[model samples]
Target chain A: MNLTGWKERLFQRYLIWSCRREKIRRYLRDSLPSLPLPDPVDRRSVRVGALQVKLELCKSPIAFADLVHRRVKEAYEAGARLVVFPEYLNLLLFGMLPGIEELEKDYSTGIAAIAKNEQQEQTDVISLPDLFRFMTPAVQPLIFTTFSALAASYHLYIMAGSYTIADQGAIVNRAYLYDPKGELIGYQDKIHLLPVEEEWKIKRGKIFNVFESALGRLAMPVCMDATYFETFRILEERGAEIVMLPIANLEAYNYWLALRGIWPRVQESLLFGVKSALVGSIAGLTFTGRAGIFAPLELTSNRDGVLAEVDCFDNEALAIADLNLDSLHELRCSHPWRDHNPALYRRYFPQVYKR
Target chain B: MLVAALSLAGVDLSSINGYISGLINLLTAQKPVVAVLPAHSALALGLGVGRLNSSNTFQEASAYYFAEGTEWTSEFLNLHGLLAKELQIYLVTGNVIEKDEDLSYQTCYCLNPAGQVCCAQRQTHLTRFEQDLHLSRGDKLDLFRVGNFYTGLVIGNDARHPEVGRIMALQGADLLLHSGAIEGDQTCWQQAAGMWAQVQQNQLYAVEAQLSATIANTVFGGNPSIIAPCETTFGNTGYLARCNPGEPLLCAELDKETLSEIRNDNPLLKLLNFDAYTEICGSEPQ
Candidate 1:
């Protein structure tokens, strides 16, 4: 075998050894006793929880599981039937690698270090998509099992945020949903890619899926997908009652920029929107957003469209609110979003998109 | 470039000629490259003879408000067109243009600096009030040019539909001019659903001029403002300038460089999934 082939095999083995499942399970078992007791579930309305998770680097898979388990437990204790986490949730698994914490403190230095480690002589910077592609095989299983176990153990439905993985030689950001029985419900790939993602060669997904769950018909669209109205319109047309958005915004939190997402979408689509945010910093990129649960202004008691929201942008907190399905159904029936001129749209959308 | 938005309140339809003279004087002072007036500002003149009240039926209200017909609309357009030429600025105004005897459409007219009607966009989406008045819906979306910027116009409730603004952006519009009105207090959600969200989604500069007059027993009020993409605006608030209740005029400069930067940085339109939208549009609404 060639020397380069041997080195690649060794690197793969090291990643597998670093993310071994036994350590993660041991951490989960040890952390179980410290978790809060579950609150009695309310049968009247669907209580949803959105987590504003502070970004953290873990020393191993165990530490990542501990961070995730604690948040899941807290939401369950708060009587939340369904809980959502932020985008790039599995990207936190990078924390499990040795020396990654110091490297991630600065993006340029991290890229330099990765390039040196990978022995890429042709380029000074390593491709982020390629790095994620290599890491996916080792990390994807850990992410799935951890969320599945948490969902089943808590008897709660979970939108486990999003993971960027290599699919058919293309990187795509995909969001996953787990039912109460720990079964995989379905997944929705992000339809809109941020410019940075485009730089990393992440391909945009072509389909929007509305998954049928115990709570209701739910659609999961990651971060930038919420920036476009077509995402919500398509989901609404497909009969999605609840839309879960997982955001890891790269920009500083401005109230108006934040309004560009799920807040106005709920107003436009008349669908309940649950948004989970990843806050703090990773890879020298700062993420700031408030986790929020939004409904139509008329349905909300304050008529503000925001049902519940985290108090601050950078802090970790859970925003929980009861989604009155009956009220939503009534609003939908009355408003009936039938005014969307499909005939007018059919003219421009095809020609415009064709360009 | 400097842009201005005018909100008309307590306008007496009896002396609209005096109102237009005062408006032209105000625009001359501001000297904006473009100015936007509120929806139904010109058509309100018809309401002068037969004033609307709570007792009037839909038929009564429609007849009374549209009595002036196309001849009056032509005079109104000529008035605004001459005003645009006099000020040497692009002007956008809304009027109810009668199509034959039975049909009338809520149209937004954009008059160029040359005082010529460059483009007219009819409201594709109708409000409950417009529907009750039996207003005809417009079919095509069009764009006009203001200086170097390709601009689109949306009247009243058309701003509520994201598709209108998006199609304009797709057609290479960098600026959107909206003339709309709301009965009673404008809610936060209602405001967000208009130009603010449109600017964010389309990454374009927008000027929204709202009508703030009371006709019938209903009181109309809105905050007229100039808006831009959040990243380009001061404090990232998405508003370059917003007028208060009693304030009728707002003027602000739109930075072309900043708008280009925002669009270049994000390029959201390029990422749109057209095939998926096509499939969704083809499917029946659930």
Candidate 2:
């Protein structure tokens, strides 16, 4: 708290910062910008085709990271300026817990803590080794490094929808939006969680957030929040041009209704204004083919007419579309639906959100 | 004849109690009252008020919100001002002023249709944010009349509380002017209901204008403006404007005659049942 103590601490912190900086420099000589990757055809002026966003339904927790890495590379090849993937992509890489013998050798200490905590709760405590019989740690950093490198290498934007990761000791569900330079520009922690999935050790987000970047303003409302039109309305009010949603859309009537039915109704309600691109996913069941783009309701951008929808029920191909930022504004100006006012009709209804 | 303009959109709390003397005076007033719909904007576009800080320039402050936020009342007033240059344009606001509550006293300006402020609303709602910070909510619901129409301004969220709308209506308000924001599809259902109530129950007009989006939800079209009738079951009809990022302006016309026909048929406004109903209700069903 004193000046001298603060000075000493500041100096020590600076030293640590420089050391970390130097270590990264040693591995990655010079800033990644100096590297000569071919220019992207200078297509910034030309309006691209329909915006196609793909969600790589990763099978294993460890596979989640690699899947994003691979799909991002594919998206770049497909010429997608923005690409999104689902929640908990990295955790899937660890695969399920490994067998008991391997768990005993590899995770005995961690498992003991789990057993002790379980016993305290008055529940049956399975040994870590026994639990490992089904799942194994996939080394999350391996996946992180791969996506980070790919983003840096390809000069693309990526929305790795909420993922469960350890920071210090807590497991948090975090969303990261990487810029064209592969720099992590925006971070939104999931504010809401699925009531059914409690084991993921996820924490709720305290704020509804938005992010600004070179492409435009973007925000992600994890999974459940996407269903709340208020979330999108607030985002639109806040100047969010595009909303990237990375959902683990499961196969249920409600989920299906959201992806197909309700989303279109929302698109119509715009009266003639606000056009936001919907890029999202449904994890686990790849069969329903849940990932795709929802726009064209307001024809500012080229009607790529749903450029691509992937078969998520299985290991499938990616959805592709060329997104044009200018077209969004242009359409808003031209469409009447965007400008209609309902108060003129003399109708007033009340809306309430229940916890 | 002098005309007074009023709009009550999405706020139902302003409905007058039938037994109250305030309700009787409001129903008997004679004026060519027209209620206009609230204006619309995008979600990211903060209302103009969000930008007015102690030191920021008006231009710099305005940039903090999307251009659409300031366009609603300013645009509509400017358009109407042009049509009736010699006629007075009385406007109403729906919520507390978004920014510069201090300036709200000076906010009302009378403009000549060219979109200049001919008149502005005094702050009607309590100091919303500054009460905890540096300001307090305004206690007075200020009133002004142009032509035969008596007008008052209440913030948009205030419309949900009927008293704000009813107070103005009771003080010989032929119409109410509302300006604020509402986000999403449910707005359609709510706005429709308000239009019906204002015309049938109040026997008056309420013009509702609103901003399209809020800071929380960024997916919406334009403000759905409605002109509610004081009679009939036609419901409210008008235009739904797109949000700034999405589309263009939507316009519609409201037939004023519907007010007369509904008033003639609906006997609920004339019948005396409050005494019996109150007595039974007050007895507590022993």
Candidate 3:
């Protein structure tokens, strides 16, 4: 290397380190408050408390209803106000497309009984394929009818991670956040598709969404979408005090790996004002249960990291953490990224997307 | 002893000697030691020896290039520095890509012993294949100095971008370490070698350490004996070490006095301006 070249490299590195040093210092000094408890609906305060998240992978569609009923009772008895299930909780019927013709006959009768809230009266003779098809058609309407009844019966919120609604032939993954009052207060469609599904031509989501719930304005990034940091960043920018990721982490080892791990740390450091929890289920072949809660940004040896992590692979477990919203608001006041020279970044990477 | 080399722009070549000697003085005196880990390629998971694919998809491929490896690499580098005692291990963040839908590369990060990223810089230019892959272009060139020792890092394809090495020199990097994977060159082997020579000329003490043959599906096979000033590259064993230019696992001690004399004699730092170049390039239509 020549004399001139060497000096140039030194100066460039200096600028970068200078920028990072400030960020690191900011992360160390500013300690955000813990999550606040859920207050009355009329109050503007953010609620942070013990919320137990459980992911139950019902092997098939036939056993799903029974599992849901039993789990609800157990979770309620254990004092869980909100419980979540994967995209197709009715897996009992999801795998049976081959016998659609035969299944449809039984499905029509069962749908009628389920619609009328007479679940016990519904015939159990229906095949899995029939049930799977039944779960697809009028998914939203039927889901409300069933989960609302369950929510009313238990007086708890069932944040169904997602269910594919057959819009014509195209299925849209949608999550329904049901209130204890049997009202569906929030709904979010899965924005990113599985790579295979993407290859199959599923329509990419047109909306980057965050919905206001009793706990906080929650942002849900479906499955693969969480891999993209923008979704989480957008949630923070849009006043989403709490970010809930309801995903099917069907990777080979049930490992969320880097996406599940490092990203939350980055978010905590830069956007110290938000508490993010990712609840994932292993539905694939090696269903090593990796379900967990990512609490607000906290100090970990000078770097910001996840306050808590739930189990990655297991049958069923609830990871709980306290997230105080008041502290988040306080941290926002002193955020460095929020005060960065926007003009400089704009001038640098002109094509960068903004939410 | 792993030495990686990269190309530099003519503008940065003027002050290269002083920068290198100053760094040597800092190392000799303050003794800030660092472990510079190269970023693994995305191919590490898709079709390489390293089992970085903890997850199933190609998306995990990005992690192979720069994720927990960044964590482990940083941690390991810190450990190396500790082993050297007074040597403070500074991690060189090779070029790192951002987590984007487009899956483009971002800034490279190097960690200090405290696990803090002490220095980081992005590759401002994209190579041919990188452009084909649609990698995002970076803006500023960066070089970091800790105590006195300074090093510029280039990861994977960034090794091929001359501006990165040059920019590092202008910013005051003493020695340039380039971490990359050189898949076997097809028929255009000579052209690639010529490119390497250009980079070496541009960045005075340029060192290019490649992952072993098994790891990278290496294409370049020039005798390391005639290549590096050091007698070894980091992490590779099976080389003839006593040769003059050295071999892989090649380690070289910089001649601080000689380097300093060169910089004093050719003090062209002010004459070659970056502002003028950027002004012209910035206005050019892409």
Fnat per candidate = 0.55, 0.00, 0.00
User: What lDDT score goes with residue B46 in model 1?
Assistant: 49
For candidate 3, lDDT tens digit of each residue in B16-44? Answer: 34323433343444332443333332233
User: If candidate 3 were superposed on the true structure by all CA atoms, what would the RMSD be?
Assistant: 24.2
DockQ of 1: 0.55
A1-355 per-residue lDDT for model 1 (tens digits): 1223676668767777766667655555555543344455433489999999998877676677778889998998898999999998766777765556554654445554443344344433335566687778778777777887788778889999998998888888999999887788988899888766776778888889999876888999999999889899888888898999999988888888888999877877889999999998767678899999999888888778888999999989999999988788887776622265667776677788777
Best by TM-score: 1
Q: B243, model 1: CA deviation in Å?
A: 0.6
lDDT tens readout by residue for model 2, A1-355 = 1213575446434433432433433343332334355445332332111222333333333344445455566666676666676655543433322332343333334444442323323323343222221121222334344445556766666776566654555555667777666677767766545433333344556565668766577777666555333344445555665666655544332232334222432252221111112233322222133555555443323332343455443344555544555665565455422321123111211110100
Q: Tell me the TM-score that candidate 1 gets on chain A alone.
A: 0.89
Stretches > 4 Å off in candidate 2: A1-67, A100-140, A166-170, A198-201, A252-289, A300-307, A311-313, A333-335, A338-355, B1-286
**Candidate 3 residue spans exceeding 4 A from truth:** A1-63, A77-81, A88-92, A95-135, A153-155, A254-284, A299-304, A336-341, A348-355, B1-286
Which candidate number would show the highest DockQ if scored against the true structure? 1
Please provide, for model 3 over A292-321, each residue's C-alpha lDDT reduced to its tens digit, 9 standing for 90 to 100. 444433322222344444544434555444
C-alpha root-mean-square deviation, candidate 1: 3.6
The candidate, 2 or 3, that scores higher on lDDT is 3
Off by over 4 Å in 1: A1-8, A14-44, A105-127, A336-338, B10-12, B48-63, B66-75, B100-102, B113-115, B280-284
Query: Each candidate: what lDDT?
Result: 0.79, 0.40, 0.42
The digit string of per-residue lDDT tens for model 1 on B1-286 reads: 9999988754445666766777877888889999998876765554553333322443454456555456667777888888889889899976566574576787889998889989888889876556666777786898877778998998888888888888899899999999977666754457777778888888999999987776554556887889898888789888999888967788999878888898787687887777667764424455
Candidate 2 C-alpha error for residue A73, in Å: 2.5
| DockQ of candidate 2 relative to the true structure | 0.02
